[model samples]
Target: MDADHLLTRRTVLATATAGVAAGAFPQTSVARRLRREPFARAGTFASGVASGQPNQRGITLWTRLHDIGASERLGMEIARDPGFARVVHRETIRAAAVRDFTARTRVLTRRLDPGERYFYRFFTRTTQSPVGAFKTLRPPDSREPVRIGWFSCQRYEHGFFTPHAGLAAEEDLDLVVSLGDYLYEEDSPAKLAEREQSTGDPNGHVETLEQWRAKHRLYRSDASLQAMHAAHPVIAIWDDCEVEGNWAGEGPSSGPSPVGPRSVPFSVKQRNGFLTFFENMPQEPIGSERFRIYRRLRLGGLVDLFLLDTRKYRDPQPCEDATFEGDVPPCLDADRPGRKRVGPAQQRWLTAGLERAQATWKVLGNAQMMMALDIAPTRPVGYDSWDGYGAERRAILEQVRASGVENLVSIVGDVHTFFAGELHTTGRIGSPVVGTEFVGTSVSHDGIEVVGDEQQSALVTDRIVLSNPHLRYAKFGVRGYSVLEARPDELRVDFKGVRSVLAPTSETYLLKSFRVAAGTPRVRPA
Candidate 1:
């Protein structure tokens, strides 16, 4: 029988068994344990294991049991050694069919030591999960240097995940940050196709809850992505593609609806997308606000990472245009005072966090580009990004400047190109620089070349750099990730590019490096 049929059969059998037990024993604790014991030996850990949301005392670990008949209890272990020789903690966790057989748990304070490296794994009676490792955050007063690897925009059908493999091999990385676009909701057009056809993957959009779950499963099946998650703890946030392209969280479509006008409502689709995302990712469980993802993480006294949600609480894209081209001119609606990108509440939270943060470096884990980019003489592009909410952007920068926050830097993605620039309050050519922004290239998504050929793409990039004086460097048509090293006196970023993602494996090299000295808001070649 097919997998779906098998699942249906198992569900029916489990339900029948549960009803009989409840009628016989009045649903006591002992009866509940007995009901779950039979399925403890039924499944395999196909999705591997992951750890994330690292704090000084603990971290969250995740795993999924595939091909299971019912909810099962599993053994979890955390150790200081990869060989499991120094086991420190052990517990029992459950993988429930209600959560698609996925199990997530947190090992928090009083159980683990701070600023230490630990390994973890999950196991059933017959099968064992691969061991994953994570490093806990240092003490708040410590001045340790932190290394982070960040990337975004990995459409499964676009190319291979060689960048993930590269990141997994980095021994010095403390954690990996996924800015957004972990997976695409739908396949792109044919002309941009890059993956091999022999893979036999489905080609269309996903709308239903089951389809979204299956999409997450397909993406998790990637060995390289699994390896990266296993190697380091991740801090992740979602962008537009996580649900639908150019989707607004509040109401209707901001630009164009990927789902037909009469199909499922935007709210339902958003819930499905958020549910699957939480089920698959290694993060905290959803709470009162079901879709809340914006949060903050602190690494010692050196870095404060604020991961933002640019999609969930924002106004729709202004001018009703989401096209990825620069042909559209600047619209007056984009400059309206009330237009919001991060929404009012989130803006207040971010500004308050910035004002009170004691870390030496304030890093914004932004999903989209923050620096203004002008494609033509007077036509600003990327209205879907910070450019669409000029008033809010200026207000935030003005707060940063007036409050005298030092060493502010934003690491962003979703543009599929590498950019290092200075951010100004008004986004003018010679405006006072308030911070530095580093936009990393995508892992495998098509860059500017998707719109034009190599020469034409280069010409457009050149024009953008020349038009924006605050921009120190820009590179078009590259596929790779970036690494940021934070120290007490300076912050450094290195853009690493892959030779090709069409192949299963490719060589990676450093494209460029830039740095900003403490208290200086300008970016310079390192």
Candidate 2:
């Protein structure tokens, strides 16, 4: 059977008893037999444990066993406290080679309470994995504040994940969001040289399934990244680097050719990327169809978080091929109707969700910048983002404006810079503001390289901000993450930057802060 199909079937079987009070467990006899099997102590759970997809009732937990042979039965436990003295749920699960020795299970028991913290761990009879913790979401009617930390574009070879460590230490964060580029598929020669010197892993472009899996493993080897996963539940989404740099789900070239062999078809590479992503991340499997990552999560009366898969369902970039990056001459194709950033189904889903959402803040977990970036008057750059699909972006903004969806904020990644701007109905400045967009800087990717030297990049960013009136802030050559706190009356975002990612340990400081009032869609410096 196809791997996607197999995982889908497994997910169906696992979630069959979702409505029951306790987790769906094996039969009594089979459970007893599995429990009696001798523990395997040959391998280690080096990847650490992760929890995600949190709901009012439960969340998904994930971990991988390294250096293990064949399948092994493991014990799983969830508790109300770190001590495990008050265990709420326990089950015997298998870590199978078919799934890359990774075990991901959903613990959705009625016994679990909402707005509560829980600890979990995976173990064999002998070895125990690190204990992980997560907090279940509050009920939709509750009026509590929600604190979220988000980061993106962490190419392992670029620098140490110091920002991730900082986020891991944030005890007040209710959730951590990974807005894509979780791991880069290819690294530049300079970065590769650095990796060879540092980690001694010469692994370059990842194309095949095993290569993709290896890349994920290599990234997961980062203790800081693993610490962040162990500390908080993550809501992860992918950007271009997870597969090819500028890939579109349906397009010629599917963005640029990777650094290694092009023998593998783009479709195969895409499938392999998605397979490894699902296998490694703490997300539930989507049944058989092309894996859909766009979904909404409600956080009491404060937030309705819409996580979008902008790459998978988007149409090709306008005027030029989808693989093309940077500024291009103005063309008619960009304004043409029916070009989609998020396809029709997703558009409808997002529109309906925004229109019907009663939460105080409607947050879009966008993978790329949605604000227009004009280097010159009326000339937009970066077609890889929403600037490529002008008509669709306008449509969505217009719908939001028409429906009176207030307190709209989009938290974005990719582009490797920090940006705070207003989402206008039209791409041009002075148009009616429909929402606010806060684009976070990369975890380690160099934003200065995207432009030129430090001075040149600063000049270019200044020009961009001056050219676009709606843009409130633009800072290039920074490496860090952003924290968003949503309350009933306002939404506040703080861009946190690290002193250096080259050093294993660095201090973080607030680069900037912005806030949006309840009914206002404009961004203002806080």
Candidate 3:
């Protein structure tokens, strides 16, 4: 590698040094900060409050203070109850200008117990935000049922984030997992105009840091997204839309038919985008790994969620010579042993983590569908998914089969469809169902819109099941998310969606429910 390439590589792997200015307020100023009447009502916490990257002892608390005046330390209060009578932790945290006036901190307090719920809010000298809450992760050996809501692929312009409003209202959720496509990067003049009807987001493709921040700001401004975060702590493993569509590591779109506008050099845009993500969201330091986002979160004693980064370090799209989109040409390179999806380090990390996990359930928080969805008889393969890289996918599945994991579940998104299927050593049957996958549909992105009636929906669902035997349930052309409930012996998922996105409404209904028993490798109606 050239010296520049080598330096950029090092920067990517080095521990992120993102920082805000030192606390401008003196220690005594905290008392005054708290005493001031709450000023920042809805507009101050416009982006909203969020918590993520949780471990046994701690979780990160995030909020972006709109303080253009000067740098200052904000007062924060976290309590076990809404009354604030049982205050767990209180401190002064700084919102640094270097971090774009956003304050994100990894809070580790000994007094805070694991497997518990806590509420948090921020206060400046003049204002206070809405009280948001999150639960600390349980010890891996704790034998309690874990509740998680999995969601992905939301397009703000497409419709209202109504599901988020519903999800926030849910009282029984422990946490939420965003699978990917967190923000849509494709913005044109027309699309931006339509999106502005909801919030003020910059129109056109997101290339610069300003534009990226604008996009994030727009998404966070949505009451639905904010409500979801305010309701339950969410840990997100971003997919392609985090940067550009179908983007692999080290560059923008590749292959013969790449989509989206070409970005700046891989080093610049990747660094900015990744840093913006950390600054904007409730994420901990990525350490020396740079842009890599594959990490593990231990939830209680029964669940280990390995949030895999499928987009950051993947090899180029397979079959560069093929036609665009759905075209599958005779590409001999897909099965090559060296074609990588999660890169070498991340793959090793996930494999080792899964093998070493003692949790009763190892939940792979994948951003894309793990199962192979054959378009078949017309077009055979999909380049953007696991179907493109056959060798690496099977390698993971082979380990799943050989490792004898009691309960391995992969929850995925990105297809804008809902599917509950068995994970076999291969895509075909008789390959041994080693793992199971519950694929949630989009949050607001368009699904199969043609199926507008009950008959069409049934027909579409039947065709999918008939085409893929391992797929027990399939719902195409829907916009919603899934709630995953994991116990020692069984895992149940409820596919919930809204009726319409064109209009603003919060009502959502359960479209389907499936339960997967331990060691069964099949999904049955719940």
Using TM-score as the measure, the top candidate is 1
Candidate scoring better on lDDT of 1 and 3? 1
Estimate the lDDT of model 1.
Answer: 0.81
Across residues 373-484, which tens digit of lDDT does each residue of candidate 1 receive? 7776445765787878888888998998899898999999998999998888866556678899999999888886645576776776788888777789889878999999
| Superposition-based RMSD of candidate 1 using all C-alpha atoms, in angstroms | 6.2
| Candidate 3, position 89, lDDT | 74
lDDT of 2 at 394: 90
Cα lDDT computed for each candidate against the true fold: 0.81, 0.81, 0.74
TM-score, candidate 3, is 0.86
lDDT for model 3: 0.74
Query: How many residue pairs collide in each prediction?
Result: 0, 0, 12
Flag regions of model 3 displaced more than 4 Å. 1-43, 188-194, 197-203, 256-263, 321-328, 377-381, 449-463
Residue 322 in candidate 3, Cα distance off native in Å:
5.2
Clash count, predicted structure 3? 12
Once model 3 is optimally superposed onto the true structure by TM-score, how far is the C-alpha of residue 20 displaced, in angstroms? 16
* Per-residue lDDT over 1-526 for candidate 3, one digit per residue giving the tens place of the 0 to 100 score: 7764453233322211111223423456644553332322222667889988776678889998874544455667688887565777766566666677688878898878888888988765445678888888887668889999989988888877877877887776778988888888776333344465322233356767766777788778887888889888888888887777677777665664233344455456567678787787787656686655677877887788888888778888777524334444656776678888888888778878888888878899988877777645223346777766778988888876677776889999988989888888765576777888999999888875443688876775576567687888887766888898888898888999888766656568989988988767788999
Expressed as tens digits, the lDDT of each residue in 1-526 for candidate 2 is: 8764563344333322232324344558866554444344446889999999999898999999887777776667788888776878876566777789898998888988999999988876446788999999999899889999999999787888889888998876788999999988875544544454222134455678878887888888888888999999998998888888778765433335444456477788788888999899999654465678888999888999999889988877665553224444575677688887789988999999999999999999999877887777767765767887888889998998999898889999988889898888886677887889999999988884534676776677677789888888888878999999998888999999999988777998889999899998878899
Model 3: residue 335 alpha-carbon error in angstroms: 2.2
Clashing pairs in 2: none
